[model samples]
Target chain A: MSVLDRRRGEIGLGDVASALRSLRPADADDVASIAGVLGFGLRAADLNAQPAPTPAIYDHQRPLTPQRPQQTPSHERLPGWAMPPLLPAPEPLPDDVLPSQIFRESPLAGGGEERPAWLGEAYRLLPQERATPLRHALLPARTARGVLVAALATWRTGSEIDVTELTRLLAEQRMPQRLPSLPVATLERGCQLLLDFSDSMVPWWEDLRELAQQAIAVLGDDLVSAYEFAGTPAEAQRWDVERERLVAWRPEAERPILVATDFGIRGTPSLRHGGAEWRAFVARCVSVGAPLLFFVPWSRGYWPSHLGLHPQIVHWHPATSAAMLRRQRGLSRRVAR
Target chain B: MSHYTPRNFTLPADYCFRGDPRDPAESAADPYIFSREAVIAVDVALATGRPLLVAGPPGCGKSRLAETMAAVLRWNFVYQTITSRTRLEQLTVEVDHLRRLNDAHLAARSTSPHALADRDEEYYHPGIFWWAFDAHSARRRGLPESVARPRSEPRFPGVERKPPDEAREGTVLLLDEIDKAEPDLPNDLLEPLDRGSFGLPDGRTLRAQDGAQRLTVITTNRERELPPAFVRRCVTLLLAEPAREALVAIAAVRAPQAEKTLVEKVADRIEALRQELDESGRRPPGTSEFLDAVNTCQQLRIAVDSPDWEETWQQIELVTLRKPMVTEDERSRPA
Candidate 1:
């Protein structure tokens, strides 16, 4: 016989009787079937011989009556063997107990708030050395002499026909003549400059950073705001003009953002989405009537073709020489003014 | 310079020539919304007789501006799409070498004494710019008309026909997507574009007749930076994205059958999606995509704000809004 058969043999008639009593079978056939399954000799009368004890009466005013046993809903009911023992409920805390008390008792009480690993690493990787201050004299003008000449020429001849004047002449009996006048032009405006500190701009990092410092120093308060941009714009603070040091950056926005970078939007994974973001940024600037300029080391090599051309964006490049740098500075000064 | 008047000309039936300078209905059935700056730039370019260099995003009506100008002014239109392989010669004239050789062989074999063999003008096929130049000159001299009507009939059915007249004078040369060509192409165009003339390899000169300056319109997507020298010679215009109201006006003409409410809904959805895509660093859907969605919805007879509208839109958006490569991943994600 197998182990199962030996175990069944070990269970006596008394054990079978106790099991049948606990089951509380309703029918005589059920009682007989339970006894037969357990290999015990039993009749319906044998189960009836020992009935369960009754409960004591507690209330004198009411007649002694047995409470009907609670019935388990069919859907919620589980087999007796499958049901697990219920766990003890947790004790409620006293009203006097404060949250701070609990916190103080915990191991992490003194640990402070947790930060992501990457953010901490980024902070660590931030540049510590102060950039060399670019000389203001070495910086170039904002707009070229040729561009200025062209602007002047356009101003002189590029004007709308005086339609009202023409109509007045026609109404009177005189030949309508073409009369042109220059439109009101804003020569100076406050501008913002963005310095690129992204990984792609590492090659010209020092030069661009120094240029930004130089611009701020020369333009003084005319430069509305200066920012350091990687994936997004962050305002540079703690400006030590003499020492040429920018201590920290916080997120900010200013109009007419002149960015100094390689214009490499394809550098990082985040920049894969940079094209759309950059375009939207530019569109926002345009909507607000702000000029967005891109200052690059080499305009031909660094400029993104995908951005297309924009009148708002004045791409100043190839400022490798002191003369060119001075020209760019002059241009920036003009724009800032 | 005198303003060239179009004689015996009739506007296309589909086009509504309102004659109002403020309204662009004279250009096409749909009115073009030119920004005040763009208008000034165009006027300046016309006055100076310089090529107007328009730089803008792809499909932002850079090329269409030239076509509209041609249609509005009743000038003969000539367009050339530049590619990486486009050569200077292709822009001027294409020499039929094989045909020339065949003509030479035929001339040599001919026994007739009267037969003369010469590198005739027949061997030279004029390019787009050449055609524009020749047409303008032809119109000026009152010579035989070389301009031919488009072979394809009007695409719009049941459109009324307008009265025909004598061929119009002058030509509008549209050099589209010039940035797609080599960087040197723009630089090469400087001399011809400024002088209104270029020389052929066969020692013949092709020059615009006096007082008949061809209106040259050059469009760039900024795929390449144009030479500063080239830029300096031309009047420049930068076309930006239109406002929502402007877009709605544009839609009224482009998709006349689409319901106003439907167009507004589509445009709003497109604008929202564009912003979301831009923020998330994805390629935002363009004006063309929005128009396509509106057209598809109209054709499919999908009613707006119906019980199944949301469900239907979810399906339609897959084909229209989602980029091809990103569609599968976008589908699997929860809406």
Candidate 2:
């Protein structure tokens, strides 16, 4: 017998079934060749038969629910069968797996409730202390001005002449010319201000909060929305520029969001537990296309962790001085615009 | 001479066009897929006669946009790649001090006064902006001057000049990677950019001719913060990272010989890898890396569906995407 014939004869029904399962025939010729190699009389019914679906090692769909492990003989060996050893059953997920549940219990997750007693008492004792009115420092606007004088200058003469130079005959018929107004560059978008009010930021909390309030006031209440993030984000009341008092705000996703944070707390238990919460907030920020701006305190020397090194984050050091913070915030607002 | 209309002109063979539809033979191939916002930004920049300041991540086609626009408009193109030491005067006119010194020495030895006067003009070499402005003038005057003017003289002794026919219709000045220059450069650009003119050291002003305003395209990788006053003068466009479908299309264009499935797989893997890197706080690979990997795969002739393909892909990825010294803190974090 020929080598091809011998090889064809060696092919069994099992081999044909395996080949049919794996091969995706491009055309009728490929299908015929595959069938011919098997040395079997190919029937339409055999080709049409659907292969049994392989059992999944891990059930990812219902992650929390336990699944029964698959049973296969430990030492059963089949010809040409190549598969990895069956994986052990997956472990059950932790009870506090959800971020929302963890966030509710964490002291770092700020609201009026979980904060220090002193902070709450201070707010109650001090009659709604208004933030100081910000003095706007105006920088000189740089303008480019020049005379566009050209040699062999073409001037249309009848009643109109565009001439920078005046000669004898040219001066006689020279008419006053009004150049076309130059186009003004306009900013089409506004920014949303996101403030970080986590527990680690206790020292700079009042100053940063006041800065955020001033930013909102300067940018106009309608143009900006203030957000405070501790364990999760909350819409903070902004100080209205017109009224000169704190006013309520609603979160809007349309404007460009600029997140302000110190990113100081890295190793605290609450922060460690709130990792998922941080990720979710980041994902939401990314989904909404928000740009983060880090407001670092100079003395703390705190660096952002891996979670804080997101591509969207921009860093700014706002030291104790409120003037510097206001300047940086104003610059950021301009840059965003 | 007839006025050159961009709508009617065709891109010539010699020009080395960089991005999308890169194959010269495939004339109908549409390589670039521009977003609606990008198109609108370009339209606005053109309409207002403002320089388009395109800021984006490296290798995301900020510089390529200039070449693409020039090709689309069928205009004359000039590129100035900015570096740290690039002087402000180099943008307009560079006086050859050594040449002037040599010429002065020769004039002092010679008897003719005309030679000394003739050499003064020779010392002042025209820069890229001058070329663009002059080319615009040549077009307006209906002169037989080449659409793209050749440099007056070589920067150094034996450098050969490019062939003349390479010049096309009008001018598009591409100030590529402007952020690489000194902090003051962008601010210095504001005056010339706003006036559409600048004065040479010799007191002669190089201005844009009457009708046409030379299109200026400035690209920045955002390495440093540009002055706000300078940024305010130009129309800005931020090119965000492209979506998966756009990236796949870009990959296919970059490696035309590779199978569609193979290109898609590479693009998907690249996207996933980028995400992984971003999460790990490592600098992620951009479009250039994706292109390099796809090109390498095509050159190696690796079959996408074969068992060996995965191993080959991993090897290629090491060179292209893998950064040395991934942070230990990132690796230890829970998934």
Candidate 3:
């Protein structure tokens, strides 16, 4: 019992009323407890008599008298009437029959709804697998698209009329200007998704898949071109969704390249990745004017320093958000506001 | 720059919104009782000319606020529900290429080609923003002496605007369910919303008249997170689930012919159902559903204590109050 209940014997109605008369807002709970204690000392006539409320949620308006189900079926009560069964009864299985044998004989037969009460003990607790977003996410799902949009979006001339340009055209021609297009900023140029499937990245395979999905979800399937490589990006193979085939990977000029890699760390010794082959690959990207971005799961310490700023490396970590990317680009800090 | 400073408009604190219930318009709203704080938010938005971004669950009368406010203020009302494919140009303005092309073809075919006034004003189609800014200019497609005929002003079916008199012509633009739009849609509206003006293809800026007053109200179900830039610019009002007393008051106003006892009984049931549904992590029955239940009881004459009404009442609960909610489906399932 609460300590408030222990003080019930000493407290009286006048004491409770006096406590409430000067009750400060802060001490309201104490006064409430005191008033609750005074309720115990009330007579039957002191409190007005009231009927109990109907049970809520179900049967709130149920009839007063208890109604029971009919003991006999209508067909049984009717002497001359007969009704056909809707569903055929299943043949009973013997207790000695093995579960495997039963399954082999009747593979489609699942458990019926009318199971024995004791069978409830046989049921195992199946814990639910909840899909928590961004648990294993390298790039935070909410901010992933924002980061890409800020990073790779380019300006292209649009077919819509530009008032400023139209004004100039009309002034020069000395007449009413017809429709003229203007420059519009958008993410029209799609990106290449190069995924690392080396032995070192086995633990982060799911993350790679999630990264691809997030990229696709942001840009769209047609925009996110897919490529897969075991250890070396130079030897990467581009896969097509429709033809179900793989082709040699090459960097498209002016198209941003997003690579999910670890720079060949913890791979087999024979696999010569992140070496001269990687440098040549970087050189090819530079030649083609492709803006390469590495979504490396490893920290900056693991990245090769010899690449010389040709490709930008974004730490593929949970802490990586659009704000971090913006800050990295020397943009205005949101915290300053 | 402020719309309120130069105007004679004043929103009384004691004002209660009594909309026409008998009108069967699509945006027809019953009497709305604003929470004490909601009225303050409305005042803030009104005084500052900022869009009141009302965030609430579906069917909590967020959309109806604009229509009712239109009636109360005697301002022009423009209603448009946003979808995923909604473009910013469609809201502000768009050039009628087809109409312009047809005009050009007719001018070329006629002997006196100059007879067809091939002007930019004739090809311009003013959108909701244009109408809200200056209704008169918008009717003529933003040109006073345009050769094209004036267009009909947009309005709800049964809403009759108070005839222009001493009060200046103003507008209430309702962009309902804005969260359904693409993420950039809100950000794209920053300029037009802040300045009360948008650039036209005809090299003219269609600006809000200095003498006219305007208030924009946007409602969202929060299906997507709005950009912070967009949210910060607008005054926000979050509509909470009404308390029991408020619910009863709503029912009394919405269904004035409904019996008091029946309304009370239905309100009590709604309270219990709301509690259970909230506990189960589901959206509770909102104000719209409450009115529906009360109306069902009054129309069918289903008494809470009547044994004959038991099955019918249960069926009503199944369909109206709880059918689609996941937890509600569990109760009537086979044992």
Off by over 4 Å in 3: A1-145, A148-296, A299-337, B1-15, B20-29, B106-117, B146-160, B163-165, B325-335
Clashes of 3: 0
Point out the higher-scoring one by TM-score: 2 or 3.
3
Cα lDDT tens digits, model 2, B1-335, are 11111122233332223343432543222345455334534544554466778777677877777767665665566778997556567777666655555556677888644444343445565567766666533222222244333224433211112223754336678899886664457777765677667777676666666565467888876644455556655556677677777777776556678888877888888789877755433456777777787788888888788899878888888887664443446444432
Query: Could you give the DockQ of candidate 3?
Result: 0.04
Best by lDDT: 3
Error of 1 at A309 (Å): 40
In candidate 1, stretches whose alpha carbon ends up further than 4 angstroms from where it belongs are A1-132, A135-337, B1-31, B106-117, B136-168, B329-335
DockQ values per model: 0.01, 0.02, 0.04
Identify the leading candidate in terms of DockQ: 3
Q: Write the per-residue lDDT of candidate 1 for residues A30-127, one digit (tens) a residue.
A: 45544543334442111111011111101112232223123244345322111112234458888796555333454555447676587756455567
Clashes of each: 20, 0, 0
Which pairs clash in model 3?
Answer: none
Tens-place lDDT per residue, model 3, A267-301, is: 34444445787788888898998877788887776
Candidate 2: clashing pairs of residues:
none
Q: Which 10 residues in a row give candidate 1 chain A its minimum summed lDDT?
A: A48-57
**Per-residue lDDT for A160 in model 2?**
17
> Which model scores highest in TM-score?
3
